[model samples]
Target chain A: MTQTNTIRVLVAKPGLDGHDRGAKVIARALRDAGMEVIYTGLRQTPEQIVEAAIQEDVDAIGLSILSGAHNFLFPKVVELLKKEGADDILVIGGGVIPDEDIPGLKEAGIAEIFTPGTPTSRIVEFIKENVKH
Target chain B: MDLIQSVLNGEKRGIAKMITLIEKNAPEAIEALKQIYQHTGKAAIIGITGPPGSGKSSLVNQLTKKIRSEDKKVGIIAIDPTSPFTGGALLGDRIRMQELALDQGVFIRSMGSRGALGGLSRASYDAAKVLDAAGMDYVIIETVGVGQSEIDIVKLADIVALVLIPGMGDEVQAIKAGVMEIGDVFVVNKADKDGANRVVTEIEMMLDLNTEKDAARPPVIKTIATTGEGIDELNEHIKKYWHQIANSNELAKRRKERIRSELISITEDHILNQILSDKSSKIDSMVKDIYEKKIDPYSAMELLIAPEK
Candidate 1:
C-alpha cells in the first residue's frame, strides 16, 4: 500500500512586520508544489505562530519576518514550540536577515534560513526532503 | 489510543494531530474518530459565514473574546478555498484572532475548503469533533458565505449566523435566497459603515416574509467588529438559541442528520476511489469505447458498477 501524506505547512509572518509580499508569494508557490500551505497573514506574534503550528499539526513552519526583531522573535517561537513539547516540527526563516544572524537563528533551532533571491522551488525541495512525517 | 486520550484530556498537540490526520484522510482516521466519538457532542458548534469582505473573521475574534471572558474554552476553524488547479490552499483567517494565541483556553485552526463546497472542507466536521472531544465549550466555524457552501453549515452547526456588511448590494442579492433559509441569526457587521440599518431592514423584511406562524424568525443584530460593538448582543442571541435547541429535540435531530450526510459522503468517496484506483486499463478501454460510440456513457457506468451490483 502506498502510504501518502500531504505536506502541511504553515507560512507565518511574525511580529509587527506588515510586509507580506514575500510570505504570500512563497505560500502560493508551496501550494503550487502540491503542498497544503496555511498563510497566517501579516503581523503575527511568535506565540501565535507556534500556537497555529501546533493546532494545525503542520510538518513545517515558514516564518517570514522582515522586522529587525528576528533575534528576539524567531527564538521566542522556537522556545515556545519546545516548551509545548513540539520540538519535532521543522522551522525555517526567510526574509531580510543578515548573514551573521543566520548562525544565531539556526542555533536557536531554526533548521534553515532562506534569504532574498532564494527561489520558492528551493524551499519546496528542501521541505519535501526534510519533512519529519 | 494515546492521541485520543490526550485529545480527551484537552492536549493541544493531540487535537491538532487528529485534525491533520482527518485532513489527510489517513487510513487510521476512521478508527481514531470512532474511539473518541463518545466524547464528542459536548461543545456547541456555531457557524459564522459571510461574503469575502464582510468582516466575518473580525466578528469571530470578538465572539471568541466574549466567550473566553465567560470562562469558556473555544475552538475555531476558519475555512479558506483551495486552488482547484494546484490542490493547495492559503488559509489566512486565523490572523484576525492572533491575540488569542497565548490563551490556552483557545484553539484555532484554519482549514482549506478542499474542494468541498457548502462553505466547509470535509475535514472541518471531523476537526470540530476533535475540538468537542477536547472539552471546548464552543467550536466556531467561519466560512465564505457567498455561495452554495453556506448551506452545509446549517447541517453541521447548531446555530448559523449569516453576517452581512452594509453597501454590499450585489452580495445581498446573490446570497439572499439561500442565506435567508439557513441563517439562524443575521448580523449586520461593519455597522459603522453607511446603510447598515438598510441591510438590517432588508433582512428583517425577508425574514418577515418567509417566517411561518410557528417558525421563530431569526433576529437581525447590528455589529461593528472592528470596535467590538454589538458582539455582546450577538453572543446573547447565540447563547439563547443554544439554550432553546439544547432542551428541544432539534439538537438530536441535527446531529442525526449530520451523521447521515457524513456517512453517505464517505461511502461515495470510498466507492469512487475503489473504481478509479489501479483501474487505468479498464478506464482507458471504457473511454476508447465511448469515444468510438461503441458504448454510451450510461452503459459504461453500468458496466463499471456491475461488479458491485
Candidate 2:
C-alpha cells in the first residue's frame, strides 16, 4: 500500500547522459509541486535506477535519457522493477525521445513519455492524477 | 519472512524493498523489522554530518570507496531536508556517490528528512538496521546538517564524524554547542582550501576543554574529498574510534537509549494518530475551546489526554 499524503518520485538521468539541466529543472518542478523528488544525477545505470526507485519508495520513476539508449535502458528499468515485484511503481520517461519510440516504450510498460517542450505543470498534474497513492 | 530471508541472503532487491517499506511506515515494516532485528548489530554504523556545502556527501563517497577497496560491503543512507510547507525533498546526495552506484558491494539510498525536526527521517535508523541486517560491514548515515537538531545522528550511529570546512565563519562555535558532545571524530573536509588548519585547531582546542581524565579525546583529521586525499587517514580514525568503543559499555548504553527514544517516538505518533482519528475523542472540542479562549491550552491539554469515559 502507498503512504498517505505526499507522493515520492525519483528523477533519474540514466545511461551516460551528462546533460542534467532538464533533469534538474524537472526535479525542482516536482518539489515545488509538493512531491518529494530524489534526483539520482547523471550516468546512472538502469539497474541503479530501479534499485534507487525501490529504496526511495518512489510512487513514480521519471527516467530522463538522452543517449539514444531509451530503447534499451528505459525498458530495462521497467523490466527489472517488474522482475523484483515492484511493477506497482509507475514508470515514466522523458528527454530527447522520438515520437516513433514512444509507442515502443509504452508497450514496454512505460506509463507515459514526455518529449521536449512538455510543460512541467502537465507532468506534475499527470503524476498527481496517476500515482497510486 | 520472504523479505527477511532475502535480506539475510544479501539480495539487493530485498534490502531495497525492506528499506522502502520502513520509509513509508507501511504496516508490514513492523513485521519485517521484527524478523530483521536479530540479524542486525553487526554492521558498524557511522554518521557523517555537516552543514550544507561542507562536502559531507563527497566525503561519504570517498570513504565508501576506501571501505569497498578493503573488500567490505558498505551501505549508505543520505538524509536530505524536506520542505515543511510542502513535505517535498530533493535528495541529491547520490550525485556525488555515483561512482559507487555500480559497485555490487556498495548500496546507497537517499532518504528525505520527511519533516522530521531532527534533520533525519524517522525511518533512518530503521533503514540502517535493514542494511545492517543485510550483512553490510559498514553503514554510513550522511545527514544534511541544518544546525541545532543535527545532533540526533548520535543516537543512531556507533561513531559520529562531524564534517567541517574552511571559510565558514565561527565554524567551530556554530556547531560546538549542539554537536560537540555527539562527535566521536571530527573531519575538516576540503582541506586544500584556505583556513582548514584553523578549523582543525579550533576543534582540537574545543576537545581539549571537554577532555575527561583517561578518556580518549575525539580525533580531528583533514581531507579533500574530491581528490580522496586523507581519506585513508579518516577511515583509520573511524576504525580506531569504533575499536575503542566496540567493547565498551558506552556502546551498549547508546544502543539502549536509541531503542528507548525510538519506542517513545513510536508511542507518541501512535497516540497522536489515535487522537486525530477518533471523532468522538474530546481533543477536537478541547482544541476549539482553546482557540476560543474558553480554556487555556494547559487545561485543555489535560482534558484532551484524559482517559476516555
Which residue pairs in candidate 2 collide? Answer: none
DockQ of each: 0.62, 0.53
Q: Give a tens-digit lDDT track for model 2, residues B17-78.
A: 78877877799998989988899999999998878899999999999999988999999999
Best by DockQ: 1
Name the candidate that leads on lDDT: 1
Docking class of 1: medium
Tens-digit lDDT track of model 1 for B77-146: 9988887887777777877777787799999888878788777888888889999999999999998546
TM-score quality measure for candidate 1: 0.92
Give the fraction of true interface contacts kept by model 2: 0.63
Model 1's alpha-carbon lDDT is 0.86
lDDT of 2 by residue, A60-82 (tens): 99999888999999999999999
Query: Which candidate's TM-score is highest?
Result: 1
Mind giving the per-residue lDDT tens digits that candidate 1 earns over A29-81? 99998788887777887777888898888999999988889999889999999
